[model samples]
Structures are given as C-alpha cells and as structure tokens.
Target chain A: MATIRDLARRCGVSVATVSRVFNNPDAVTRETREAVLRAAALLGYTPSAPARTLATKRSRMVGLAWDTGHRGPGWRHPFLQELLVGLKTALSERGYHLLMLATGEDADGHLRAVRRHSLDGVVFIDDGTADPALTRLAESGVPCVSLDRPVTGRRATYVTSDNAGGAGAAVRHLYERGRRRIATIAGPGRTHPGAERLAGYRAALAALGLPLRDEYVVEGDFYLGGGHAAMRRLLALDECPDAVFAAGDEMAVGAVRAALEAGLDVPGDVAVAGFDDIEPASLVRPALTTVAQDRAGFGAAVAAALISMIDDPDAAAPPPTVLPVRLVVRETSGPPRAG
Target chain B: MATIRDLARRCGVSVATVSRVFNNPDAVTRETREAVLRAAALLGYTPSAPARTLATKRSRMVGLAWDTGHRGPGWRHPFLQELLVGLKTALSERGYHLLMLATGEDADGHLRAVRRHSLDGVVFIDDGTADPALTRLAESGVPCVSLDRPVTGRRATYVTSDNAGGAGAAVRHLYERGRRRIATIAGPGRTHPGAERLAGYRAALAALGLPLRDEYVVEGDFYLGGGHAAMRRLLALDECPDAVFAAGDEMAVGAVRAALEAGLDVPGDVAVAGFDDIEPASLVRPALTTVAQDRAGFGAAVAAALISMIDDPDAAAPPPTVLPVRLVVRETSGPPRAG
Candidate 1:
C-alpha cells in the first residue's frame, strides 16, 4: 500500500531522488540511495524485480526459450520436469527465477521479446528444431546457454550428455555379449545427439572390425512409432541382426514392442539397447537396457554457465559442457542364455 | 543500442522529461509522450520490462511455486512434464511467461519472493506440502490458482481432477468384474485428492451395501514404494481383497509389482487399479486399469483461470474447477473368466 512518495517524504528527499534510488541508483549520491532504500524497507514497500532491474541492470531472471509445441502432443522431452527441478533448485540458491520465453514461428519475434524483457541471459532447450535462428542465436553475442545443442558464441555455451560415449558403450556392451550382427535405430541426422550417436555406433563397429552394412542403419525420428517401423524393417532383412541399439529410449521401447509382435524373444532372439534411461525403460516388459543421461545435471550445468556468463562479463563464456553418461544394463540386452 | 538521452536529444526534450515518459508516462502531456515514444521507436530504444512496469504497473509475468525437492530423489510428480507443456503452450498464446518461485523451508520466504516479483498472478503446483503459507496464499488477496489442492480466496481458485467420481468409477468397475472384496491403497490423508478419493471409495462401498472393513484400507504416500508396502500389508491380511485401487499410477504400478513378487496373478488372483494415466500406466505389465486424469487439461484450465484473474481485477475469482476423469479398463482389472 505504500507509495514512492511515502519513502521520499520519510527520507526528506525529492521524489525524483527516490526514483533515482531504484531507477538509476548511481545517478544519486550513495547516502541518498541508502537512505531511500532503508526508508522504503521500513515502510514495507515491495520493490518489483523490474524496478530492481532499472538500477542494477540485472533482472535476476533467466529466460528459458523452448520450442516444444512443435513436437506435438505425443512427443515429450524426456525428464523435462526433473530438469526444471534441478535448474530451479540451483538458481533458487542464488535468488533467481526462470522466465519461460515464448518461441512462436517467428524467430525474430522471439528475440524481440527477449530484448523487451531485458533478460540477464537466455537458455535455449534444443527440441530438434533445425531453425537457423537458434544456430545464429549462439553467435549473437548474447549471454546464453543451449541444452543438448553444440552451438557456442562469445557469450554462449552448451550443456549436453556424452552422446557419443554412451552410444559407443552400448554397442561395445552388445558386442561383449556375443552379438556379432549389430544394427541401429538412430535419431534424425540433424540433431547434435542424433548425429554424434550415429557416429559413435559406427565407430564402435569399426573398432570391432565389423563390416558396415547400410541395411543395418535405419533412421528414426526419435519417437516410438519411428522406432517400431525401423525395427520391423530390421527384422525383415535377409540376415537379421543379432542385436539392435536405439538412439533414444522411446524408440527402444517401440522396437521392443515391434519385436514382440513379431514373436521374437528379446535378448534371446535379438538383443536390444537404447539411450536415455527414462522411467519406462525399467517399467516396460524386458526392462530396457539403455544409457542414462543426467537430465537434472544438464539443468544445473546450464544454470551455472548462464550465471557465470552474467556475473562475470570479463570472463570467457563457459565452455560447452558434456555431462557424463553410463549404460544401465537391464533385462532386454543381457548375454546369450546358453552355448 | 539507443539510450533515453539519444531519444530525448532527438525530440529536443530534457533528459528528465524522457525519464518521465518511461517512469511516469501519465505525468507527461499527450503530445510530449507521443513525440517521445515516436522518437524511441525510430531510434530503436529497447525499454526493459521493468521500465514498462514503472509506467503501467503491470508486469506480464506469472509465478509458479512448487515444492518438489522435499519429495526426495525417489518421488516424481507423474505427468508433470505434460502438465507443464500444456500450461506453457496456453500461456504462450497470451504472451505470459512462467517464473519458478522458490519455496524453501521458510514459508514466509516464498511470500517475500512473490511480493518482490510483482507477479501478475501465480499458479501453485501442489506437492503435498500442507504449509499454512499455501492456504494463506489463497486468501492473501493475490491473484492465484492452485493445482490439485482445493483452497479459495478473494482472488484465488483451484484446478483439480474429479477424485471422488474417478474413485467411484474405479471401484464400480472392479465390482462389476465379480470382485466381492475390494480394498484401496490410499494416498496421504492431508492432500485434497487423497481425502476425496478415500471418501469416494467409502461411498461406493456403502452404496453397494458391502461392509467397509477398516482392515482393507491401507494409507500410503503418493509414491511407488508406499503402494508396494501397502500391497504387502494387504497380502499379509488373513483375508485378502480380490481387487485393489491405488490412488495414483506410480503406486498402482508398485502394487502390481508387489502382487507379482508375491506370486499373485494380476487380474486373476488379485486385480489392480490406479489413478493418473501416466506414461507407464499402459507400458507396465498387465497394462494397469486406472483413472485417467486430464493432466494437460488441468494446465490449460489453470492458465485460463489465472489469466482471467490477472486481467479482470473487479470480477469474482473463478470458482474451483474439478476436471472430469474417465476409467480406462486395461488388462489389470477386466472381468474374470469361467471356472
């Protein structure tokens, strides 16, 4: 209920001086600024975050730009809530909040809103959008961090899982289990994770001296249906693969469903592996053997990098960070039962 | 890149006059304001949201208060990501952003943050914390909407599923399947959904003229482990119920796992049902027969109500919303076969 006038009157200063204390604190004398703030505090005047932004030039709020709507209702970002929890927990400790930015079709419109908000920094969550604007955003010199995307800039960084390592580990695990004819259901080639994971799968096969068979490599859109279709094709090949690895868990589950529908025994007839150990991986029949990415860790790392970019402008932007990943061996991809 | 000074100089106005245009636009004459704004547009001056707040006293930001961390690592809010996606998509249409408000140990701390942000409105995600602060928040004259918790204030409304109706449907479904003795794995008594569901179960049993045996009702937290423990206790009883309904999907899955571990055939020896048609509901073995709450619908409804509150200062707060739910009869609780 208190107004600026009340604080100014109590401090015996002009209203402009009081405004300056919040709008342009540096414009007024330090003593004047302190007197006004101290009086405002006593009067229980709530200073809006924007008001604080006027003086400090920092909103203490981070912008989260995500274009997830394009994914449709069927697709969900794996572990999104967990990632948000992690990001919020870390940011809360430093007195910051997250602002979910709207990313409509117009990329420029998104940037315009970002500028209007005077956001301290922005974190872009990669949702497999090949939008050139996002790629250019990393080069825009704005303090930013990308999740699961590898673009970087003067003040932009990225946080992602070790896709290549995880994929390689999955392939090697299958090989160790005596799976000689290995195949893959990969994600779209456009996404960073997709491309890197595919590369890892190939590299692992190359290291093991397995011939690269084009028929074994199937491209999926990283959803259940795509995985299922790819698996159907794999099963139809003249020489079916002894094992299959999917780039994501959703697809892996689909692959399992497809195999089961085809009357094949999982891990016995054809072993299967997947990336991203989402909840269903363990709950699904056969208990998916997949790689587990640190979804929460990605959030914490993004927050840290963005904060670092904002707090110390003098320092270089945090380098692209790759959190570790490990394979979770479950029922679906164990070794052969007998000789 | 343009400053207020540049715009002021361009318009041949004093720097104070330009400041007034942003900080106190009403104080300036219409002609002077028009000239200043036109010049600002021409010069590409980016006014911070805080500056706009100073002029209009409206910050188009909403607060999201959730206390999920306390639930510990093992606990996860089922369908959170879907709920958030729905909320964000709807909010995006209105150019509103979500601000994650930190609700740490100190209840007052949450309120302080709320006040500091000058949020247009708030949407509180209920995470089973019965802090009086949340109850009081509804009555604090701040425009707010609660999810899954029923509390109303002058400017507060809540969005929740039809717990009672859903529970009754589940019970009746089990009964029609020839289950004479029915039991329930209930959620915490403190939560609104939990209490309402328990009441619904009792009402259904009473309506059926079946004796409400206290031994059949087992209380569990809204988590997987709780349901598992509750199921274990139920199995140990001298006379086990033929069918069990868990208040949540996670718990229902746990109950199924417990029944299987105890060598009981689901839908044969011991039927199971659950609420919340989360992703794992259909994926888990026996495909849980559960009550499907519209998680995304809850988000959309919450957004609509909160926005209505924020936009209309004089109208009455939207009344509490109880979204409809439907019974999904899957493999878990189908009718029994011939002897």
Candidate 2:
C-alpha cells in the first residue's frame, strides 16, 4: 500500500500541495494538479475520509434509529417505506451515510453502535413517546430529529404529520356521511402518535354531541390480528355502531375481514375508515376510505430538520414542524343505510 | 475538548500508559488505571477512535449493501425481516457496526460510500442475482456474503434457504392431503428464488402423476392485489384446482378473500397454502399452511460466512450453506372432497 506522502514525493510536490490538489484543485496550478492526480492513480492512493472528517469536524454520517419491533417483520407498514426513500434521497445530496440503529431489545448494543460509528446526526422514526434513544442522543451532543413521534421534555427537533388533525378529519367525514354511532379501533396508547389519535377521536365524538360508549372503542395493537379481535368485540355489542374508524391500515383490513365474515356488506351494513392509506388500502375490495399521511413529505421534513440542526447546532429549533393530512374518501365510507 | 496527551502529562504518565487505561485497562495496574480514568474524566478527555482505527487497520464497521428499490423501505417480506433480526443479533457479538449502503439507482454511489466508509466486510441481502454490488464487493477485496441468492461467476461466500426443497415440501403436503388439481400463484420468473419455487411446484406435479394445466399457473408480483386478480382468473375456469399454493403469504391472503367472495370455504371448499410463514399467516382467520424458512438461522449463516471471510481472506470458502425448511400445516390445507 502506498502512502499519500509517497505520492507527494513521487509527484515532486510538498504534502500540503498534494492535499490542496485533492481537497481544492482550484488552489493548485493545472500542471501540479495533473501530476498529483497521475501519481495518486498510479499508486492507487485513496484519501482517508475519516481523518479528513476529524480535521473538518464533520463526520458525514447520520444515524437512522427505528423501532424494529413496533410491527412484526414481513408486514412492514408500506407508509414507512415511502418515508425512507425520501429520507435517503435527501441525505445522499449532502454526502452523508445512514446507519441503522434499532431501538429496544438490547439497547446497549444500539448505543455502542452509535458511539463506534461517530455519526454526525440521528433521525429517529416510529418510536414510542418514551424512547431512551432520545436521552442518549441528547447526551451525545449529536443533532437529532424524531419523525412521527415528538421527542418529549427535550430540545430535540421533530417532524411529524398532524395525527390529531387527521383523526378529527376522519371522524368528521364519518359524521358527514350520516354515521351517528361511530366507533374507533384505537392503536396502542403508549405511543405518542397513537395517544394523540385517540384524543382526536374522543374530541370529535364530544363535538358531535354523541355520548361515547365504552363498547364502541376497543384496544387494537394496530395489526390485522388486533383489528380482527377488536372488530369482533364491537360487533358482539347489543347495538353495534354503524361505522368504524381504525387507527392503522392493517387494523382496518382486519375490520374488513370481520365484517365480511358476518355477512355484512361494506358501506351498507357497516362502513370502515383507516389511517396511513397503505398500498393494500386501494387494492382491497370496495377500497378503503381513510386518511392519507404524506409519507414522503414527512420523511423529507425530518431529513431537512436534521440537516438544519447539523448546519446550526445553536440555532433555535423552530417548534417541531407539523405536516398536514387530508381525508381520502373511497368506497368504504358513505351515508348509513336504513336498518 | 482536552487532548489525551494533555491529560497524560498532568497524570505524570506516558501517552501509551493512558491509552492502556482506556483501551486495555486489564494491562494496567488497577490503581494506576483508576487514577488515569479519574484524571481523564475530570478533564473531559475522549479518545479519538478513528485515529486509533487507522493505526490498527480495523474500523470494526461491516457494510450492508442492498439494491435500491428492493428492500430500501417497503420491506413487507417476512423472511427478510426475520433474517435482518438474525443478522443484527449475530454481528453485535463481534463488535462490528452495520452500515447500510444502497447501490444507488446506479452503482457509482454505492462504490463511493463503500470506499469512503472503509468497511471491513459486506452482506448483500435480497438483491438481484446479477447486482453490481457483488462485483464491487469482490473487486474491493472485501469479504462479502450474499443472503438468499447465489453469487454466480464469483467465488464469494453465499448463504440461502433451500427454496426448491421448501417448495417441494409444500407440494408434497398438498398431495398428501389428497388435493390433485393443485394450482400455484408463482412469483416473477426472472428471480432465482421464485423460479426455483416454480420448478419445485412442477416437479411435485410430475411426481404425483397429475396433469399440469397451464391455466392453473398464473404469474403474480408476489403481492395481495396480484394474488386476488390471479385467483379471480382461476375461479373463472370451468374447473378450478382443489387447492392453491401461493409463493408468498400476502398473495395467499388475497386468495383467501377471493375464495370467500366466491362463497367458498378455505380448506372446506378450496385449500389455500402459502410460503414464508410470516407472522400474518396465523393472524389470518383460518391461518396459513405453508413452508417456513429458518430465517434466523439464515441470517446467522450469512453473518458467520462474512466474518469467516474477513478472518481468513485466503482460505477456501465452505460450500454455500442452505438452511432447512419445514412444512407448517395450518388450517389452510385439508383433504379435498368431491368438488
């Protein structure tokens, strides 16, 4: 292996000259730059990036911390995939690397990975409200941003869709469609997004002057299985609700299956709406009426927030930027039919 | 921000002695190590890991390269998810960091990232069979391992599950259950795993002395929508197969919906079995009877292969290890009555 100094000596130039040719060619004469380039190619000399980063005080590496177990593998929420694409595309523009740091279940391992990689920043996605990665990131003095969940009690920046507003819009849509007995399959309450969505559901019901019934709301884990169980419980009620709003798409699909099994027609016997409008939402029979979170936009916002923090560590972070959401009315939600 | 050399002079010891306290504490006397540690902590001195790694010629960072547009974000495949978990757990024990490198829309970005990061080894997961990442990894003299795909024309180490064998087991399960007219929703024919699975399906039909009808086989994109459309076409036939075997669980879920829509009962009227027994398999109403890949073992195998290559670059690689598969006969498949 040839050293940079060897190339410098071979090119008949000072080491500083070679560094100038590589880092900023405009600073060196054309002839000197050509000589340095020839020597570098001949000796297969690759500049030490980490060393340069150390000198420049910029590692050019970003941490991608995620909740690996939020939903089981194989049935990845397709909504997140779009967000990832947007995030990766933006990060590449600035020449930064993404390192996967899965949270929970061996957190020490994640912390160790972070310290070893020397990441310049971290972007956390799909984590619960009380994730420890936030505190660890804070202590490390690395610029960090959270997506989908606001980092609580911390000065960390965040980018998330308007979950509460989306849920409210969904409820309003159901009410406008003439649904009085509206029920919701709320996702796990521990997660900030989930809790906010549930709050929105309650607020909408209260505004509509409808008495909230315990039997109408069932705890759903945000997967198809949980939705199926919740839907079954809702249907077993003495007077079942005319409409259902599921927090996640998977749960909504489960609700579809439960409705079909009971010989009830979608939008006639019961209407269903979901959030995150995953790929399967449109493909399923009759399609799904749901709220569409701008997944790619959310990812872009988070990436932009992280880059801003990296650019100005001491800059006052604009209050966690919240993206907007809209209701996508499909075939599922409609006016209630006569009993 | 204090330098280690400054802390060493204050502690009245050589720089090497202070390094031993941090890097190899066991080599130093406990009292001396404690003194050095206390002084360093008080001075807020931190060791520069990149400088140490450059001197030692080991970054302790493993590269994970995946073809862009594959598993970049919408990772819905259960098998891949399980494999990720397995790989993460196995490599954490070896003190190696996994850096995700997407072989950009083109291959240049991937090469740049790999060259910049100075990765120790790389594992390519679920990429195309002729992906450029394989060629780059081989040329870079980096020990590389291909997961779930064979690296053709390259002597690089590879690990995969027995796809053909898994498929054969599924067919045999269906045959034993007395389903003669067996239809299959095969994946795209260009991929290795999908092709092998299709071949296995054919081989079983030949061995069972059953006539293989061309109409019974439809190419699906391995998604639920494709499955539903394919199932609809099969249902339109003058005579449909008594059982259907889908290459993936999502497709099988679609088949379940199609069957129900046609007023057919799963296993009672039309048996449905899927491969890659993902979490959703059991969650679906009747549950899926399919072939289960030892995903964790597969992940471990890839990690172990990559590590061994790193340890002995010149040593001959063991033959490609194929993890075993099992037939999980759930409620989806049962004996076929006169249809």
Candidate 3:
C-alpha cells in the first residue's frame, strides 16, 4: 500500500528524490538513499510491474507462440521439451520470463494472442503451416524469430536445425551400409522441415545413383501412429526396402515397433534410422540410429536472435541461422546382411 | 502512433467519446461506434497492452511456477509435458496465457519472479521442498494453487493425484500376485508425494501382514537415473525382492532396464510397478504396470482452482481436491510364476 509519496513523506524527502533513489540509487546521496531504503523496507513497498512497464516500455517478457495444429498433445515431443528448457534457461539469464501463447486450432488465434500481450519479443514454433499472422507480426515491427521453420515471404530471423543436411547424412549412413533399397517416412510436405527433409532424401538418392521409387516414400505426421501406419504400408510392398529412414524420432520408434510386430529382425532383416535423436531414441530397443540436432543450442540461438531484435529493432535482420546436425549410429542401423 | 485525440478530431467527436468506443463500446451509440471504428482503422490506431494493464489491473496472465531445486532438466519429465498440454488447452479456452517461471537453484527465486510479474494468479508445482516463499505468496493473497505438492502451513488450494492410494493399490496388486518380498523405490522424502507414497507402501505391507524391511526402501530423485541406481542397489541386496514398486514411471522404466540388464525376466524374476503412467509407460518394453493418474484432469483441476481464486479471492478455500488414480495392469506386473 506504500507509494513513492508515502516513502518520501516518511523519509522527509521529495517524491522525485524517493523515486530517484529506487530507480537510480547512484544519482542520490548515500544518506538519502539509505533513508529512503529504510522507509521502503519498513513500509513493505515494492515497485509495481505495470507502472515500471509503462515508464520503460519494456515488459521483460518474451512470447513463445506454439501452434500444434490439429494434432493434439504436441508438447509430448521431447524435442520441444528440450527446446523449452534451453529457451527458459537462456531467457532467465537475461531476466526475461517465457509467456506461452498456445495458438489453438485456429492460426489467427496466435496473432491475436501476440497482439494482446506486452511482450518484448516473440519466438514462434512453426507447425508446418503458412500463417499470414506471422507476416503481419513481422510487418508490425515487433522483434520476431521463428524456430524450426522459416517464415516464408517474410524477413524475420529464423533459427532451425540443419534438417536437409541431417536427412542427407542419415541417407549417406544407410547407403554406406550397403542398403541400396532405401525408403523414407517423410513428414508432411507443407511444413518447411518436412519439405527440406524430403528434398534431402531425394537429393541423397540421386547423388548415390540409386533409383528413386515412388512407392518407397510415404508421408507421416511426424508422430508415432503415423509412422507405424506408414511402415505397415511399406511392408505390404511387393519388394520391401532394406532400410527405412524416418524424419522424426517418434515416427522412427513407431516404425521400429511395426517392424518388430511383423516378426522382422531390427538391423538384421531391415535397418531403421530416424532424425531428431529425442530421449526415446536411445531408450527404445535397438537404440535408434538417427540424426541428432542440438535442441538446446537451437533454443538458445532462437532466444538470442529474438533478444537482439528486441534490443535493436532497426538492426539489419540477422541471416537465417541453421545449427548443424550429426549422425548418431546405434543398434538400429547396421551392415547389410548376407543374402 | 495515433492517439485518442487524433481519432476524436477525425471522427468529429470528443476525446471521451473516442475513449468510450475503445474501453466500453456499449456506452456509445452504434453510429458513433461505427464512425470511431472506421476512423481508427484508417488511422492505424491500436490500444497498447501496457496502457490497458495500467487502466485495468487484470493482466490476463497466469504464472506456472516450476521449482526444479538443484536438479537441472527436471522439466523434461513426460508427466509435466502432459500437464502443460492440459493446462494450456484449458487456459486458452478462458482467454488466459501461461507464463513459465523457472525457479532456479534458489528457493526464493520463485517468489521474486512471481512478484515481479503482474500475474492474475499462479499455479505452483511443488518440487518437494519446504519453500517459505510459497507461504509468503499465499499470505500476500495472490490466489495461489499448489499442484502435485501441498504448501504446508498455508491455506492455499491444492490439487494432487492420490499418491498414497495409488501406491497402496500397486502394492496390493503385487501382493495378490503372490509376491512376498516387495521393495519400493521411493521419491525424495522431503516432498509431499514422496512422503505420502512411502506411507502408503508401509500401510499396504502392514495390512497384507508382510514385514516392512528398511533395506527394501531406497530414495530416488523421481528420475530414470535415480531409479536405475536404486534398482541396482536392490539387486545387490542379500535378499533381492520379488517385486519392485517405483514412486514414478521414469524410475520404473529405469528399474526394468536395470533388471533386464541383470538378466532377470520381468514378471518371472522381479515384477516392476510404477506410479504416474506417462506416455513412456506403454511405449517401453515389457509395458510397465503402474498407477495411471488422469494427467489432463489434474491440469484442468489446477487451472480451475487458480482461475476461481483469481475471479473471487474472498471465496472460502476449496477443500483440497484429490483426483483418483487407477492401477493399469500391464506386462511388467503379471501373475507370479509357478514354482
């Protein structure tokens, strides 16, 4: 209940002196500052966030806009959890808190939520959809950064894993194992990551002088069930592929489960590889051999990008930063079996 | 950049009339509202969030206070992910956003972060520590709701799973399966869930007329590593238990891994049961049998409690609501093998 006036009256100083002592103590004499601090401590006076925000025009908050699309419980992905931890740690170091803006079923909901919040900047998780709201936000000059997906047709800074490069490495790893009949469970093509991964798969096959079979590719929703169904479809093919590479760890786990259920040996009968080495990748039987992205580094990069933009809005837009990915070979992918 | 005066001048109305159109449209006539809206749209005027918050103390933001204590990456737990999904869904429906406040190593950091933000209310995830900060927040009447852990000596609303009951059911189920030597991997004893679960384990052993052995109980940090270490210790004991019950599913997974690594058949040698059936419960090999708590329901209950308190702080504290948990019989805890 104590205001600047109350502190000033109690300390026998002007209101401006009390405010200066709290806001900029170095500008006031040591005795005056001590007197004001003593009165404030006694009165249990704490500066209000709203008043400070109004004065500084800085909320010291960043918005994390996540759109799960129609797929529910998207937070179940361990990759997102890792990213969240990284972002939280990085932001906290700068005295900023993360405000989650869950852009539910509707894409426009994200824009509306972002507009309503007094966020210093925003980091968006691309749901593989083209959202005009992002363009609008970028145009509004709010410091914005997209994670895992680039904002198409917009100049916003983007932080993403080397999706295409990771996918290519996975394919190359499989190829070196003498698995010529390779297949892929590509993610939905509408999203940037999915499209890049699929492109990588095709490019790898073409570079290796291997024939690209249309039946070898199936689309998945980057989830366990979708991967399972896609693998089953591949198994039903007249000539099953010798190796399967999934674009995500969840799907890779599902594919492995499907292969096991069909009475097939994991690396012996058919090699399985996945991307994004999530927690389950190592826990599952045969321990997935896939491409591992630096999730924490990716998160930190995105946060740094957003914070920089927030600090200097007029600075030239930073080039889209793509963190590198590496291959993690485990029991899932092995040398080709003797015919 | 356009102010209310600019809009009023363009619309040929007083500044108060223009302000009324934005703050309370119902107070203005339809013609006046239409004229002001059309002029405002043409002038590119948008109400600032800080100004709105200053005018109305309600920030429409809820804080999620997560204290991980000294353990890093504690937020990566699947249970927390599921709860976050549910909370986001429920809060989004009510036009509220979730702010994540990661309370670092310091116990008092949570209180400082919560106090710094203009949150309408906060949902605290008790990390099993006796935090005086929570008590102070509750005393300050910030409409606090503690989830999964109760704030002792405080009248704050609490929503948690039936830890004791769930543990009892898991133990009794093991007993009915004809397993006598049962051990438990308990959580940290300083927390509520851990204490309650330990009590339940003891109560069940007493009711079943089985002697409670002190060496059979090992404390874990509610993580996979802890569970794995504790299980290894149990395996090294002079009389290894026939069945093991872990206070959390992650620990159970670790226990199962430890047993399998030790060449022990799951149900035949050492049955494993866990509490808090997370996504990994069914995904892991030998599908863990554990107590399944309604994670989404728990999230909804916590959100509802916090929102209610925010809406009506004067309302009598709702009695501590405990959601039920059920035993999910799976491959890990099958019937005892015939001698």
Candidate 4:
C-alpha cells in the first residue's frame, strides 16, 4: 500500500531520483540506490507501473496471437506453447514484454486496440498469412511477424519448421521399414503445414516407386475426433494399407486406438507413424513411432528472426528459413508381416 | 524500404508531421492523414519503431518470462499457451508492446539495454517466486505479476488455479466410484501445485475415513518415465491397491501402459485416474478417467488479474481468487473388481 513518494521522502531524495534509481540505477550512485532500497524496505513499497508507463511510454509489453484450431486451448498442444517460451525468452533480454491476443475477437477491432495501445510488434503463431487479423495489422502499419506459417505476399517477416522434409522423412522411414502399402492421414487442406505435409507424402511416395493410393489418404482436422473418423475411412478401403502415417501425433494416437478397436495388433499386424512426436507419443501404449520437430530450436529461430526483422525490416532479403526434422523409430513400426 | 523522408515528401508535409500522423492520427486533420497514408502506400513506407521509442520513450513493449519447464517448448502444453493468449489479449488493448524475455537474463547487466529498450511491465508465467531473475526485477523496481503461483511476500501480484481443491475433487470422485485402497503417484514436491495435489489426496483420504497408506504413494516427476517407474514400484507391493491416481495425465498414461504390461485390464483389474485431462487422456486406449481444468478460463482469469494489477497496483485490498475445478469420470475408475 506504500507509494513511491513515501519511499522518496524517507530516503530524503526527490521522487524523480527514486524513479531514476529504479529505472536507471547506473545513472545514480550506489549509495543513493541503497538509501532508496532501505526506504522502500521500511515502507514495504512496490512502484506503480501503469502510471510509470504513461510517463515513460515503455510498457515493456509484446503481443502473442495463436489459432488453437477449433478445439479451444487443448492441453495436448505443447508445440505452440514451447514456441511461445522461445519468443518470450528472446524479448525478455532487453526488458521487452509479452501479451496475449485472444482468438475470435473482431479483426479490425483488434487492430484498433493494438494501434491505440502502441504495441511495438505483434507475433502471429501458426496463423496463415491470409488471416483477417494479419490483413488489418498490415493495413495499420504495425510491425508484425509470423511463426510456422507465412502470411503470403505480405511483406511481414516469418519463421517456420521444415514440415515438407519432416513428412517426407516419415514416409521414407515407413518405406525403409518395408512398408509398401503405406497410407497417410493428412491434415486439413487449408493449413500451411498440412498442405506442405501432404505434398511431402506425395513426393516421398512417387520417389519410392510406389503408386499413389488416393483412397488411402484422408483429411483429418488435426484433432483426436477427426483422426478417429479419418482412420475409419482408411479402414473402409478395400485394400487396407499395412502402414499409416498421420500428419500429427494426435491423429496417430487416434489411429492406434482405432486399429486396436478393430482387433489389430500395433506393429505386428499394422504399422503406425505420426509427426510432432508429442509428449504422449512415448507415453501411450505401443510407444508411437514419430517424426520429432525440434520445437525449442524452432521457437528460438522464430524469435530471433522476428527480433532481427524488428531491428531491420529492410536489412537484407529475409529468406524463409526452415529448420530440420528427424524420424524417431519406436515401437509403433516394424517389418511388414510375412505373407 | 521507403524512409519517413520520402513519405513526407510525397505527402507534401514535413517528416515530423508524418511521424505525428502515425503516432497520433487525431493530431492531424483528416485531409492531412489521408494524404500521408496515400504517400506512405506509394513509397512503401513503414515507420521505424526504435527511433520513435528513443524519441518518445514508448517502445509499446511488454516483457514475458515464460517457463519453458523441464519438457522444453513442445507447444503441446495447451494450458500454458492458452494463458499466454489471454495475457496477450489484455496487453494488446492498452496500445502496449510484448517481448519474450530469456528466463535467466539479469537486470544489472542489461540495465541500460532494458531502459534503452522500453518496457511497461513484466509478466512471469509459471515462474517460481524465488527465481533469481525475478529477484533482480524486484530489486530493479520492475512491476511484475505471476500466473499459477504467487510470488511470496507480495513482491508481485499473482493469479493461480486451485490445485488443492482440484486434486480433492478427483480423489472424492474415486471414492464415489466405490474404489477403496486407492494408490497415488504424486508429482515432484518442489512445485507448489504438486505439493498441493499431494495435500489434497491426503485430505480426501482422511475425509473418507481411510487411513493414509504410505506404501500406496509413490513419487513421480510428472512424466511417463517417472510414472512407469512409480507404477513398477506399486505393482511390486505385496498387496497393491486396486485403484491408482496419477497427479498428471502423462504419468497416468505411463501407468496405463504399465498396468497392461502386467496383464491387468484398465478399470477391470486395476482402475486408473489422472489429473489435467489432456487430449491423450481420452485418446489413449480405454479413454482415461481424469480431472479437467478449464485451461482457457484459467488463462482469462490470470490475464484479467494481471491487467487489473497493472491498472491499479496500490488498490485498497488484494483478494486471492481461486478458480473452481471439476471431475470428469471416464473409463479409468469404477467399483473394485469382484474377488
């Protein structure tokens, strides 16, 4: 409940001096800082930040926007949260701040708030370049960056993982495991990673001299429910595949459950693989074989890229950088059963 | 790549006028604002934020100290990430900026950098009160707020979930399912939530008139590996309990695998329950029975609380608010199997 004035008065210094001690301690002598500290301790004082921000114009805040993709804030999605930490870590160095922009809020309305609030820059995570919010942000002339998905022709900066390469590797792994009749559970077509992953699956199949089984591929909405439904479609096919490669761990997890329900033994009767080697992949029964994306590295790269862009939006040609991925062979996949 | 000068020249206005137009469109007449915008578009101009921050001392930034936790940046953790979005939403409204702070950065070394860079306030997510970085922020007089755990001594404001109450609800649900001799895998004791959950488990047992059995409790680090090891110990017991409660879904998932490995059917031979009802909880075989935390609501509440503190730090009273928790009975627990 103590105010700054009380501490300043107790320290026998002006309020500005006390503020300087807190804000720019190096500007003031150590002795003066010690005195202010003693006074603050005596009065149990915590400085008022909002009023200070009004005066200094440095709220030490940043903005974060993410698309949870229908299932609001699913606890299963750890990849997005990790990227956030990487972004936050990069900004915290210079005492920068972070703020969250809620989803489903009106687009133009949100931009008005960002402009009026004076955000330094906004970071869009997993959102396509074409999101209405990005359009408004660009129109408002706000410095913005994207993670995992580029905002198309917009001059905004972006960072993303190598979804194509990862998916390709996953299929390649299936081939190496002697899975010729391999199928895929593709993600929604609208999403960037989903499209890239689908392309990777196709490319891998073509390169491996295997006929592309269109009926084997089904689009999943990237949720357990969608994955379950998609798996059912794959099963309904007359020529059921020997292996299934899902675009995400969630879908792979569902596929595993679906396979079990049909009285099939995982890895023994049919092989299963997934991308995003999520936490539960290893924890789940049969221990899913997955492609691991280095989430921390990806997050750090995005943060660093965004910071660099903020420093020099026109420094050099900001090329779209893609991080690498690896296929983790676990208990989910094995050699095809002898005919 | 167009500079402010080019835009000003195109608008037939001074550079200062152009800057003012970007900062405060209201300050300029409607005609002048329109001219500036047209000129900026023609020149492909974007305002330099750093220069403006230096001049106005408003970086429009906020600092975030995110807990990447032991698991790293998986983005799979929806609860943490959703809270982040909520925080971003509130800060964006104030025309402020957001920055992701590296968890271990020190203020003394980066004092000038922090001041030179503008920050309005610093928000810590799931960071312990005793963190060295937070201590420095306090000493430097930075305004900070925490989520999920209070920084003791009121050094900063906090928003947290009711961990104890949530755990208690899960235990009570198990009792109602007619499961006695309930064993539990407790999370690491160092964390506040983990400790609270352990307390809740004990309290519920006491309330149900069941003697707390020491052998029935095992320590888990909230991961599958730990849960697997803990389950092994429980199974090794001469007379193991019929039901198990794992503090985290990940642990419970491991426990499920362990039980199946021992030839026990879930909820038939040995019932299993978990907390955090993560996506895998339902996706895994037998669809885990667990407790569900409203992650978005938790995030919204935390963001609301932090913003309130940012608005008025020295309010008459700071009430500690606890969000309610609920039990979600699934396939995990039921009446004990007949002998």
TM-score of each: 0.88, 0.85, 0.87, 0.76
RMSD in Å for candidate 3, one decimal? 3.8
Q: In candidate 4, residue B227 scores what lDDT?
A: 89
Q: Is candidate 2 or candidate 3 better by lDDT?
A: 3
Model 1: residues with Cα > 4 Å off, grouped in runs: A1-47, A314-316, B1-47, B314-316
Interface RMSD of each: 1.9, 3.7, 2.7, 7.7
lDDT of 1 by residue, B66-144 (tens): 7764456655777787787788878878878788887584766566666777778888886665667877776787888
**Model 4: lDDT to the true structure:** 0.71
| Reference-based lDDT, residue A104, model 3 | 57
Tell me the lDDT of model 2 at B75: 50
lDDT of 2 by residue, A153-207 (tens): 3336787778888988998899998888999999888876788888889999999
Each model's lDDT comes to 0.84, 0.76, 0.82, 0.71
Q: Place model 2 in a CAPRI quality band.
A: acceptable
Residue runs of model 3 more than 4 Å from their true location after superposition: A1-47, A73-75, A102-109, A153-155, A207-211, A237-239, A336-339, B1-48, B92-95, B102-115, B153-155, B176-180, B236-240
Q: Highest DockQ among the candidates is held by which one? A: 1
Q: Which run of 10 residues does model 1 chain A get worst, by summed lDDT?
A: A105-114
lDDT tens digits by residue: candidate 3, A1-339: 567788888889998898898779999999999988988878867676667777776877888876655344453444776788788888888878798887654545555555455578778775656567766776566777887666642237788888998998999999899899999999999878888999999999999999999999999988899999999999999999989999988899899899999999888888999998877687778889999999879778987887787777578568889999999999999876678
Q: Which of the numbered candidates is closest to the native, going by highest TM-score? A: 1
Candidate 1 local Cα displacement, residue A40, angstroms: 7.4
Native contacts retained per candidate? 0.81, 0.26, 0.52, 0.35
